[model samples]
Target: MTDSPVLRLDGVAFTYAGGAGVSGLDVSIAPGEAVALIGPNGAGKSTLLKGVLGLVPQTAGHMSFADADAAAAQRPVHAPDGMVGFLPQSAELDADFPINLEQVVMQGRYRSLGLFRWPGRADRAAVRDAIETVGLGALVKRRFGELSGGQRQRGLLARALASEPRLLLLDEPFNGLDQANRDALIDTIRRLKQRGVSVLVSTHDLELARLVCDTVVLVNGTQLASGPVDEVLTLGNVQECFEGVEVEIDEHTLVVPGHEGH
Candidate 1:
C-alpha cells in the first residue's frame, strides 16, 4: 500500500429525512486493501455506501477520492466515471429483461464512452476481460434473465468490473448466494486486491469479512469501531453491535446465530 490513501472519509455523515442515517464515519482505504463494513439490516451500511456514491445527502464532514485524476477536480461525493465501481445490493433491472449478459456488461462502459461515442476495440476488450474475470465468459451470449441467481450476481459484478475502477464498493453481495457462489465472490475479491484495486464491502458475515478484509468498520446508525479486523472483531465489539446475539469464535471458526442469516 502507498502512503496516500485511495479513498478517505474523515468524520463523514449522511442524513436522510426525518433524522435517519449514519454519522461519525472516519476511514481510509489504501490501494489494494480491502475493508469490510459489518452491521445488521438498517444499520446504515447501505446508506454509507450510497453516500459514497453521492446518492444520499452528506450532512457533515468531508470525503475525497485520489484515483487517476490527480487534480481531483470532481467533488468527493460526485464520483467520476471509471474512478469507482459500485455493485448495489439490489439492481433495478427487470428479471425478464431482453438484454444479454454481454450487453449488460457493456452498459458500464457507457459513462467513459460518453455521448455519441461508440465503443471501440478497447471497450470490447474490457467487456470481455470483465466477463472472464467474474468467471462468466461462457454465459456472455446467454440471456441475462435465463441465468440462475448466482450467475446473475456474478454477471452484475462483471458489469461493475468493466469500468476498471480504482475503488470497488459491494453492498451485501454475499447475501442469498449459495456456498459455491459465495466462494467464487471471495476469490474474485482476493484477485482484485492482488491487482491493487481497493474494495469496500458491507456484509454481516464475519467469516467472509475475516477472510477477505484487511480492516473492518462496525456501525449502527453511528460509528462503533474501526481498525484492523483481528483487533476490532472481538467478542465485546460483536456483542455491542448485535444486541442479545450469541457469538462464538476460535482459531478456525466463527459462529453467530442470527447474524449467519445474512
Candidate 2:
C-alpha cells in the first residue's frame, strides 16, 4: 500500500447561505486508518461530512483525496466517479418503494456505468461481493423495507462498498442499533481496515469510537483537538466538546452523564 494519506483537509471550511459551518479545520487519515469525528450537536460535524461529499458548498481551504488536489475555489466535491464512498446518518428509503437488497447495492455502480448503460456481469459480481462483505449475502433478495434497522444500515454500507471506494465516510452509522448489530458493524469496520480501506466516521458514541477508530478529532464549531485516540479523547477535551457534560474515562470505557441508560 502507498504511504500517502487517503484524505487530507487543510484549513477547510464549508458554509451554507446563512454561513453556518466549521472553519479552520485540519485533519488527515492514512490508508487503512479510521478516524472518529466527535462533538456535540450543532458542532458542525455533519456539515463537515456534507462538505466533503459536495452536498453543501465548500466555502474555503483545500481538500485532497489520494493526491488529487481539491482547491477551495474549485469547490472540491466527491463525485460519483471519485474514490470516496459515503453513508449518511440516515438513508431513508421509501417503504413503499419496491427495491431489493441487490438492486440497492447495484445503484452504486451507475456512476461508473454512465448514462443508460446497464450493469455488466462484473458489476453484478461487485454488488454481490459488497453484500457479502457486509454479511448480507443471505438476504440479497430481501426487500429494503423488510429488513431490520441494523440490517438496513448494513445494506447501506454494502451500497457504499459496491463502488470499490478507497475511502469510506460514515456519519453516525451506529445510532439506534442494538448491541448485536453494533458488534457486527464494528466487525465489518475492522475487516475493512484489514483490507486497507480508509474510514472516517462521525459519532456521538465515544465508546464506539474508541473501539474502532485509530484517532479522534474533537470539534466545537472548529477543531479542539486531534491526535491518537488515547491522547485526543481525554476528559478535558471531551468535556470541552460536550460543554461541561460529565464524562468518566476509565482504561477501556467512557461514560457520559445523562446518557447512561443509552
Candidate 3:
C-alpha cells in the first residue's frame, strides 16, 4: 500500500462456502484509469467487486482503498470527501415510488451530510452536476419508474456521479440496454474518463471493454491475464480465460471478437 493505490486488491480470496470462491487475486488500479474485470458468468466477477466494496466477508487476502484496508474503511476510514461510488448490476426501484429523479440522485450525497440533515447548497449543486454529467438533466424531473431501461441506467449512473467519488465501480451497467442507451452510456463513460475519474467496471461486454478500458483484468476466479488491453485481450488469452472458448481477432475492430476458452 505504498502511498495508497487508488484501488488495490492484494491477494484477495473470498468464498461462498458451498462451491463459489475466488482465490489468489492481486490487482492494482491507479488514478484516472479505466479498468474492466471481465470473466465468464459465475467466475467470481461480482464477488470481486463485493470484496473491494467490503460487502463480502473474506476468508483470506486483503482489499484496500487509499492504503486503508476494506474492513477498516467500512468502519472508520472515511477518506477525503467524495471518495468512492458504486452502482450495482441492477437497482430495482418502485415504479410508482413517487419520487422524482432529482430526489433519487440526491441520495448519493446524503451519507456525507449524515441522517436527517438537509442538503446544503453545495450538496444540491453536486446533484445537479451529476445529472448533467450523465446527460440526464432533461430527464431528472421524470419519475424513476417511468424511465426506459437505458434512461434508468443513466439516472442510476447520475446517482453514482453525484457522490464525486475518486473511483466509480459499475456492475453490468450495459446489460439489457437498447442500442440507443448503450451508445449514450458509452459517450458518458468517455466523458467521465476525460474528467480523470477512475473506473472499475464488471461486465461481459467485450466491445465496451475495448472501446474505453485502459487495462483489462480477465478472471476465472483466477487471473487469466491482465495489463494493456491489446496484450490481454489477445486470442490466446481469451481462449485460456473463457469457457470452452474459440475466438477470432477481428482485424477491423482490433479486438478478439470470438472465444474458445475451456
Strongest candidate by lDDT: 1
Q: TM-score of each candidate?
A: 0.89, 0.90, 0.86
For each of the candidates, the C-alpha root-mean-square deviation to the true structure, in angstroms, is 4.3, 4.0, 4.0
**Model 2 over residues 31-96: C-alpha lDDT tens digits?**
999999988878899998888887778777778877666555456556446488999998768856
Which digits, one per residue and each the tens of the lDDT, describe model 3 over residues 38-58? 887878888877766656656
The C-alpha stretches of model 3 lying farther than 4 A from their native spots are: 1-4, 67-82, 245-262
lDDT per model, in order? Answer: 0.86, 0.84, 0.79
Q: Can you write out model 1's per-residue Cα lDDT over 1-262, one digit (the tens) per residue?
A: 4557788887889988778999999999999999999876889999999998888888888787774332432344566668899999998888798999999999999998999999999999999999988888888999999998998999999999999998999999988999888888999999999999999999878888789899999998998999999999998788778765543243244444344444
* Model 3 residue 25 CA deviation in Å: 1.6
Cα displacement (Å) at residue 260, model 3: 11
Runs with alpha carbons beyond 4 Å of true place in candidate 1? 1-3, 67-77, 245-262
- Candidate 1 deviates by what RMSD? 4.3
